[model samples]
Target: MVSPVAVPGGAVLGSAFAWGHGVNLRRLKYFVKIVDIGSLTQAAEVLFIAQPALSQQLATLEGEVRQQLLVRTKRGVTPTEAGKVLYRHAQIILRQCEQARVDMEAAGEGLSGQVSVGLAPGTAASALSLPLLRTVRARHPGILLYLNENYGTTLSELIMNGRMDLAVLYGDKAIHGLSFLPLLKEPLFLVGPRAMPAPAQPVKLADLRDIELFLPRPYNVVRKLVDAAFVRAGMVPRVVAEIESAFTLTAAIADGLGATILPASMAREVVAACGAWQFQIVDPVIEAPLALCQSDHLPLSEPAQAVKSILLELVVDLAGTFAATPEPELAALS
Candidate 1:
């Protein structure tokens, strides 16, 4: 009997049918389920198998791969580093297999499947969620569009994990196992209560040093950009509150709690709704970058591809609407 071949990262590559004994896809599914549920007992119940049988399968998988996948504990199990690597690859593999089945079934039929798209919250992209839903519904009546509005980092991670098809988010940094298309850049603006004095000209970073500000947490993409801009100008912002919800932020601005920094489009909305004042941030204009993120290796399903095309077209049409400057040079798969 041939033995499974282990790669540098302790991932089993080939099986007996090929060059060496390999972990079968069924076992991979079991392992993935176990990891996802974080409890073999729960996984067995979900998979409709006996607990002992599930344990035996996991043991066999570990033996074949020659790497311990889960760290079993009293409460639950967690994937080790090697287990995490396997889990990530397993998600992609399972998604690809499912996509293959779906593709075959819908070969002659029109595009008809669920496609998940994420839009980063607190950015101009969030405004596209409803438009995308409407467009997909109008063009492909059979297709269902699932939209998620969340943090850029969270959205990007979902795309990387194969859980989400695509995302419009802030950031252009190249991430492993992910591809990015730089969409456009929107300038930052300072939004404050109407009760406060409004600046006639674009406000410099230094001008904001003394003003009380309400901003998202430091991990937020827009917050990071705002923080970096202030840091470069040799000052720190006077943050009165760290707010995550747009409603709460707008309410605070309306109540004259403090000012906040936001992308041009979002700032405009807040200003309009809250009867606030907005001035562009300049003297080294701070612009927030937005990009389209997707899995670098996974081929998009037919429905997903159709939705992506529509999303791209929508972005182009709404670029000016969002006060976003289109990138002259588009980077493909960056």
Candidate 2:
């Protein structure tokens, strides 16, 4: 029987050499596959290995580090606390190794490396997705791409911790170890169901006080901006509920539960999805600044640099096509 162990604080229990020599890249990759597929059988089938052999390897991996990495239940396999930590670091290690191979193979070719990027959910769902992926595939097939869609704060934290090479997120207060490159200012819009009567003119920010609102929770950066704007306008918004998921928020608005504020791009998406109409918010013309951010503590890897350059170029080209107002300055916010 494999001995059961619990991880506390994610600290490695064994000595440095013990942890170092006991594990190999193959085992780490196998472990990650198992976690991703959520079943040893599925992972083995995908890896073209026997189930028993995969089980034995997992046992060996567990015994070497003397830590229980996965918890097997009737449903499937899930990573334990230690396994989660190992998985995150293993992803970085595997990518680095792949990058090294790509670099060697590229003797006289163009740039070859992996760039892991994090993007805010709204940004990821916008028109930028297709063009970004296509550009990378066409221009630099040697470079591997990994894209993660998350919230602004989550993306910022990932980039700062070295997990994500770059991210596009809303600029909040100054983050100490990251540099923010201003991208474009996104205007806020009020959305409601199509059946609702459209306002004759732009809805003033102060006028929002009369409308029942269903917005993201206070923890979200967008919600914070909305609340601050309301305070500045000297009116308290009638928030009916606090929702976190954008889809749920938009659906609620379409169902006539309450209206919500969203960036222009996101508002358009919801409008199309639920036959909703978006009204431009005016009076103060509130807008949020989107930025392309990266860690300032470390120099970007060659592949990361290449990806950044391509991304900047694509954003500029697309912004011009959309006639967007941009503040494209690579200024470090202190």
- Maximum-TM-score candidate: 1
Q: Per-residue CA lDDT of candidate 2, range 1-334, in tens?
A: 2212222344444443144555777987899899989999999999999999999989988887677989999999999876776676667567666667877887688877778877787642256667778988998887789888888788887876567899887774677768888877777888887666666586888667788888887877678789999898787889889887778877787787778888777887888888888887877787767778897665677878888887777666545443345663522111
lDDT tens digits by residue: candidate 1, 31-83:
99999899999999999999999999888878866678899899999998778
Instruction: Please name the candidate that would achieve the greatest lDDT relative to the true structure.
Output: 1
Q: Per-prediction TM-score, please?
A: 0.89, 0.69
**Worst ten in a row by lDDT for model 2:** 1-10
lDDT of 2 at 155: 81
* lDDT (Cα atoms) of all candidates against the true structure: 0.83, 0.75
